[model samples]
Target: MYVLIFSDAGGAAALLVVRGCHTALTAVVSNRSNGAGGNFFCEYDATHQMSNSKGELVSIRALVEFCSTTNCNSRQSTSANVFNDCNDQTTDYLLGNEVLNCYECTAQQGKNCNEKDRKCSSKKYCTKQIVHLDGGFQLSKSCSNINVLGIDNACANYDVVTNPGGVAVHNKYSQCYCRNKQLCNSGSSLGVVFTVSMLLLVHVMSTVVA
Candidate 1:
């Protein structure tokens, strides 16, 4: 069985416990704007029947059709099970198909200088990378697909090098991936302590490898 929770702009809330494989479900909603708020209870059984709070078996399809013609505004509805409550998971499900906006810029443009907002698919994450090169550091903030980076949803440090005219040049970088909020890559630091710890870990690993 699943619980369906619904709420509207006028402070009306509803909870429905449904069972069986019925094509239509009846919901007895009260008009809160007219100061007529009262209790509304609805349940469905395995016999493909629905009953209202008055213990009257009403036609599910007819009730739904009646609601549609009315001026009631039910804003949100969520389907929840026992294992999970109605919170972030429900919001995520509602926004699953929405696009994400992220700040897009590079270090060359200056710090915290976002030229435009990058529109990314819901599956992509906003990324921030700090590269420590020979001269100085380079920062890049943009939206990235996790599959293309071959990385998980966390921060990581890595090293890369190039050989030019028999000379070797190496660069170390820290990249962080986030999707919890919009424009998250615009921050100057992920966290001072966290950044320091990651740098120290990279140093220790490099020493061990050397």
Candidate 2:
């Protein structure tokens, strides 16, 4: 004879086991019981049917007896279940893609440098460029793709010759630091005069080349 007692939301339900008729009694109790849905008959007897159940229930007796030695009816968990109640609703707009945000400004001595935030388009990179001149330097920070300055590599120096005439004009630009992170190249220490000089130099170079 076996007695099965299981707990449910309302309360506990019981089943009466008759010797040599365990299977019939278990099936009847399970079908009539008002509680969770599972094949508990396997736990009610030592000899259980090899039915295609959840594979958790081993013997009907084990379930009916609630054997202290055996660990049955263990709770399972999953990623969704664990984080189901999380309140953080933050979503990534880029969805794992790179966000190239940069600070944009030009060097200009004795002049006010207008720094602004520039949201780079997709497939673009942040750049911090510095151009050395006769007695000053020009600095520009913005977003550009690999083709803008023909920078095949990050932070590599290069030269741009705008004019090659009687008085040749040479422009040397230090490696333009490129990065994939957002807002990585926003700040620069070069004075406003430097930016102004750089712009003037660029204008003159363009005019000479023309």
Candidate 3:
């Protein structure tokens, strides 16, 4: 099992747990943005931790990219290689096949983003992320083996608007995961397809606790 923890300067936190991946590979990446900054850290159980200073989004994107590029099943016997062998391997071993095709794109392509699809293994989900930053929002789609730490088939949204040191700063990040169909991440509002009730429940629980 792999455990990832993300926390920002504003006291917001999120946890992601990835299971059935290779046993040896482990990594922890963290970043501090210009204003109010954020930190992302993840660790795999059975090996040493690798750390990076890049942003949270970049860290996750790197993991997804790594999964897409490498075949973990072929490297299981080798020693842990930080970010290289972290892709989930158990599903492919058990199912013996790929299951879904997800729409793939990067935020950098801007308006000229191309239509590309990636095959996802079983237990993996098609993922879409929308990030609202200073000027506007950015979108990216890919396949991910990581799920929200506790909730199943859920979407996560974080909206933080803070005036730190009297400077206005706003950051909004949202991600959705779905495994029901192929190319499920093609819509603008893909997050709505996954249940947001978990978020609502968390809000209610926090309110009651306070």
Candidate 4:
């Protein structure tokens, strides 16, 4: 697997692990002008950037990217050598293969954002992320195509927004869903969360009383 983990000063970094699949490494690009676009770099095609219909250059505020393998993001796998095995190339989109259509969103300050389609590559998984913060939360869901080598549900404290000009707020991604089927991450996992948290709270209270 080819892993690339880039950390931003604002704390918006991702661990991407690409294996034998042939798909471009694409990202949801947003600039300071509040413009949104897509950028991808692939082996067969030259690196390309997408802009709004007006074709203006905008400053990048945040970028969220991913890959299929979970090993790339593992806690113990923190090494720069993760990208040692990757070049550039994409396998042709196969027919009848499970091309996932996932719900995609990026939000800050607990405000909701527009949801769109995220057509995933073959053998990829759908992932959902819910970030919990002080008295509020943010939500995002997308496709992940990566090999699984270890546990997927791990958490770390990371910042999401660098600027706090009432535009974006930083939050920690607290929940993740990595599933193989299409649209598996479309539904919210709130019920499970409430139950688990309640149980933990009860246990803690009991321990305190004891």
Runs with alpha carbons beyond 4 Å of true place in candidate 4? 1-82, 86-96, 116-123, 146-173, 189-210
Instruction: Compare candidates 1 and 4 on lDDT and give the better one.
Output: 1
Q: How do the residues 45-131 of candidate 3 rate in per-residue lDDT, one tens digit apiece?
A: 221111122212333222321221223212222223534444442232222254666776655424643556343334356677776
**lDDT of every model, 2 decimals:** 0.36, 0.34, 0.40, 0.33
Per-residue lDDT over 1-210 for candidate 1, one digit per residue giving the tens place of the 0 to 100 score: 112322221223543322211112211122211111212112111111222333233322101101222333231234343212212212231123655555655553245545464433343456676667666766666654321122224555566564445556666767676655665566643341122222232321222110
* The candidate that achieves the highest TM-score relative to the unseen native structure: 3
- Which ranges of candidate 2 are over 4 A from the true structure? 1-95, 112-119, 147-153, 158-171, 187-210
Residue-level lDDT for 167 in candidate 2: 45
User: Candidate 1: worst 10 consecutive residues by lDDT?
Assistant: 60-69
Question: Model 1: how far is 82 from its true place, Å?
Answer: 39
- Rank the models by lDDT, top first: 3, 1, 2, 4
Write down the TM-score of every candidate: 0.36, 0.33, 0.45, 0.37
lDDT score at residue 100, model 2, on the 0-100 scale: 50
Ranking by TM-score: 3, 4, 1, 2
Error of 3 at 79 (Å): 14
TM-score, prediction 3: 0.45
Q: Which stretches of candidate 1 lie over 4 Å from their true place?
A: 1-98, 109-112, 115-123, 147-153, 188-210
lDDT of 1 at 71: 31
